[model samples]
Target: MAKLLGLDKVATFFRIIRGNGGIFGSVKTLFRTDELKIGNLIGEDKYGNRYYENNAYFVGRNRWVIYADKVGLNYDGSQVPAEWFGWLHYKTDLPPNKDPSRPKYKWMLDHEQNMSGTNQAYMPYSTTRPKIESWQPPQ
Candidate 1:
């Protein structure tokens, strides 16, 4: 019955149209080249990033992440917490929260999203004055 009405295709079309699938997300789906897969959610990091895994896919590519930020367009990889990073890269089998051997060091810093191109980007403090003063026209 679903095939007769083409509900699958219709549903996909709507997902793309509604922006739930992203701007080019629909394009990727239409081409059958989408890299992301729906998998069993393993856990969510402190930053609210969700991790997923599906053994059905290849080993290295099986694990995936869904950013916590609703604005997928602005999502960045650096947003992933260090603990989750280990699992995402196959460095550890257990999520950070679940790993018993994981250590907590006082020097460890909290996870911070990448701010390279934004106003929040870090700027080093320098004591040196400007090399060239404001240009002055000949008197």
Candidate 2:
């Protein structure tokens, strides 16, 4: 009966608002990620990204990460380091911090996000000359 009368949606709206800690929280969340949700904070990475989980939500959808404020709206999945990536993808139930078996070695390099499309992207040096000649602009 509630579903037929559209009361379910109304209830959900209020529930979301309440979960976010009332009106102000809802607005803050809206500006931040545009989604209102309630969940327990699972962990935080060194990059300042925060991970959250809520069993009430569907399995995959229940877990998520909020990127660091420094990334602003430019945040991408690449920014998630390997340690956190494993948890995010359900590779392991325990987070990096909780997993004592994980190995750390002096030879291991620190994680870095792919920079293929940005100004820092790698450029190769060419040793051979081009077959085609370029036209020079008039000075």
Candidate 3:
């Protein structure tokens, strides 16, 4: 019972710090209560994303992902691999590891996290010269 109580308190702390549960979540628990409670770890993808579920919470809201990289909390939705995405959304009952129907076609591409705001972000190359020339006071 004491351990349970301690866990509850911890959960409340995270809720308050993260502001996950909203005003009531913050004021009441001071931590995301849901986050603190232990949940069944569903699976982890190749990219280090972890999926978890707790039946105590509502079905849709119970499932969540703990991102592998902090990335300043700027993580994008695309970071979730295709297989894990299905599990998170309730589209499939089985996780990628257990799914029998999952395909392994040669053409299928590997998963890659989004790099939108980083130095690795996509940059297209063009051969055309600049339309607007730089100004020159005097040569």
Candidate 4:
């Protein structure tokens, strides 16, 4: 119960100091009021992302992935790779490890988490000069 309150950790002291003990942590914390998902952890990937499946399927779907990082700072759809995305969204019945048909082509590049809004974003070269110029100061 103390853990649910975010009061049990020494790290919480630092977070409290950082913010005078206002609301901290995240949406996942609400669901993790108990350790409901911890025991159901079926697999972890190289990046420390964990995968789970609840046996109780409302229709026919029972798969989910929890990232190591919380949703706010690290949240982005691009963090999920193509292969794992397939399994997460029910496009494939097999996990990446167990799937034999997954390829190992030499020409293929490793997947990178997206960098669209960051400094690593793709920039195309322009062949044409800019039509509009800044007004030159009188000199």
Candidate 5:
């Protein structure tokens, strides 16, 4: 059914039905599943995101991205680390695997999920602020 809809195999019939198989309409369905053609196994990063390409994009179509099998909790965009960022957006001509110029540093930070607005959010400290504000009755 995905073939008929011109969508990736991971995409469901419901999404294709609802989105009508257009790029703009597919935004809502983005990250919902794997939607790329894998003519070749590119490379994997420490966080386990996989990259693939079909080379069919010559006509400006048929590029794809497949999240690792371990990424089950949910994709929040921040799941994608900086290393794979280049391959994901076609920024580099080589995949991380084939790229000889890729760099590694001792101070490199691990991938961190975006936790803003969530319960595990970051807390800032301020020495001048009072712990509790005085409650005042409105006049």
Candidate 6:
């Protein structure tokens, strides 16, 4: 009777929710990421970004990342490091940790998220006179 009435579809929905983590956990994840997804944990980068992959999902949309809570809602694509950037965008089949050929040199710098709006962002100090300066009225 459940199948006849199509209530079976609802069961699958509940299963997905349960897989995400029961009702409360599911709701929390939904609010945090704006969507509920079930997938295998691909790997996590040094910045604490978590990568996920579910072939069940459509091609481009199958891969995703959940930024670490330390940054709260300030996270953005710029936070994704160059290495993970390639994997996240499907430029490579293997993740950084699993990619044996990835280079690591002594001069390599650590991951630092973009700071365009923050105090750490780059600020230029120019000694040269401006090509166009504001005109001053008789003082």
> Residue pairs in steric clash, candidate 2?
none
Output the worst ten-in-a-row residue range by lDDT, candidate 6: 68-77
Q: Please, what are the lDDT tens digits per residue for candidate 2 over residues 50-69?
A: 99888889999888898887
TM-score of candidate 1 relative to the true fold:
0.65
Residue-level lDDT tens digits of model 3 in 1-139: 8576698777755654564346554444323233444367888887777788877788898888866654435557898998889889999878888888888999998988788788999999989999999999996
Candidate 4, position 69, lDDT: 60
Please give, for residues 21-92, the per-residue lDDT of candidate 6 as tens digits. 899978877888899888889999887889999998999999999888798877788889998899989899
- Which stretches of candidate 2 lie above 4 Å from their native place? 1-15, 18-22, 131-139
In order, what lDDT does every prediction score? 0.74, 0.88, 0.73, 0.64, 0.62, 0.88
Error of 1 at 58 (Å): 1.1
**Superposed model 3: Cα runs more than 4 Å off:** 1-35, 69-75, 130-139
lDDT of 6 at 61: 90
Pitting candidate 3 against candidate 5, the one with the higher lDDT is: 3
Q: Is candidate 1 or candidate 5 better by TM-score?
A: 1
Whole-structure CA lDDT of model 3: 0.73
Q: lDDT per residue, candidate 1, 29-117, as tens digits?
A: 33443343556779987767778888977899889887765644577778888788888998889887777888888998877788999
Question: Judged by TM-score, which candidate is best?
Answer: 6
Worst 10 residues of 5 by lDDT: 29-38
Overall local distance difference test of candidate 6: 0.88
TM-score of each: 0.65, 0.78, 0.63, 0.60, 0.58, 0.84
**lDDT of model 5 at residue 4?**
80
Candidate 3 deviates by what RMSD?
7.7
- True-structure RMSD for candidate 4: 9.6
